[model samples]
Target: MSDTTTPEQLADDAVVVDVREQDEWDAGHAPGAIHIPLGELPARLDELPEADERDPLPIICRSGNRSGKAVAWLTQQGFDAANVEGGMKQWAFAGKPVVTDSGADPQVI
Candidate 1:
């Protein structure tokens, strides 16, 4: 059996970093994910909690490209960061829950 976690395994306790631009974030993103936009990450490293330094931190973007770079950077910075496999697009395609400003706010179970 594969030990890989599904989107269902994601929780508030897991650190999910969104590295897209502010415009992208304002649109929609993984619920509970921390927005650190790639441009500011280098200078904003301190804002990330110490727990993320040791625990798994999943970096995400609209697609996986930017987050891949983020994963590399964070790993180099001594943080345990990983790319969110296929990013939000995959999450959405997989029928995972997402938050959007489409009038009614649906809850993710």
Candidate 2:
């Protein structure tokens, strides 16, 4: 099983990758998270940190399913990765910062 990290456990400098679709991302996502849909990750491997990096890549989806899969895949690829348990839904529920392209209040889509 993929390792998991809670939203509350994330550090300020952690690399957070959102694996939701473009439309979902445009709706809302964690502030400072890198937008890379799950389907695009294979081609966009360079956009992520090097496999040898000490910091783990914390990934999230609308809920946590997709990101859990991503974490499993990433770990197999030699990268330190973890799923963000509870995902964006929990982040927003925890009153964490979120942003959207529309300049409206952020909501999990």
Candidate 3:
């Protein structure tokens, strides 16, 4: 299978890393997804799930663009990673839960 994944393909509990900006993340994100802005991914590598745990860690952003870049960089570092196709927009549209830190109604920003 390709390294890009649509939100519906993932299990509800699938582990994911969201690489959007702080404000974007605060607006809405996949419930339970790890928040690691694209710029901070390098320093937060140790906080990621085990390299083999998820087989290929799923990375997301507001759109697929940033996560695609993240996947490329992570692949070069020998970390298995995949971009979430269509990103948060698709994830929310697919009926998956979006959550905010403040417990407000979630909507993709």
Best model number under lDDT: 3
User: How does residue 12 of candidate 2 score in lDDT?
Assistant: 42
Candidate lDDT values, in order: 0.70, 0.85, 0.87
Model 1 over residues 18-62: C-alpha lDDT tens digits? 898876776666767788999899999988755444347778787
Candidate 2: which pairs clash? Answer: none
Instruction: Indicate which candidate wins on TM-score.
Output: 3
Instruction: Give per-residue CA lDDT, model 3, range 4-42, as digits (tens).
Output: 878988877677999999999888888769999999999
- Of 1 and 3, which scores higher on lDDT? 3
Better of 2 and 3 by TM-score: 3
**lDDT score for residue 36 of model 1:** 96
Question: Could you tell me how far off, in angstroms, the CA of residue 39 lies in candidate 2 after the best superposition?
Answer: 0.6
Q: How close is candidate 3 to the true structure, as a TM-score?
A: 0.92
* Deviation (Å) of 24 in candidate 3: 0.9
lDDT of 2 by residue, 1-109 (tens): 6678888887544569999999899888887789999999999989985533555778999889999989999989888888999999988887778888789877798
Model 1 lDDT at residue 20: 84
Model 2 ranges off by over 4 Å: 12-14, 50-54
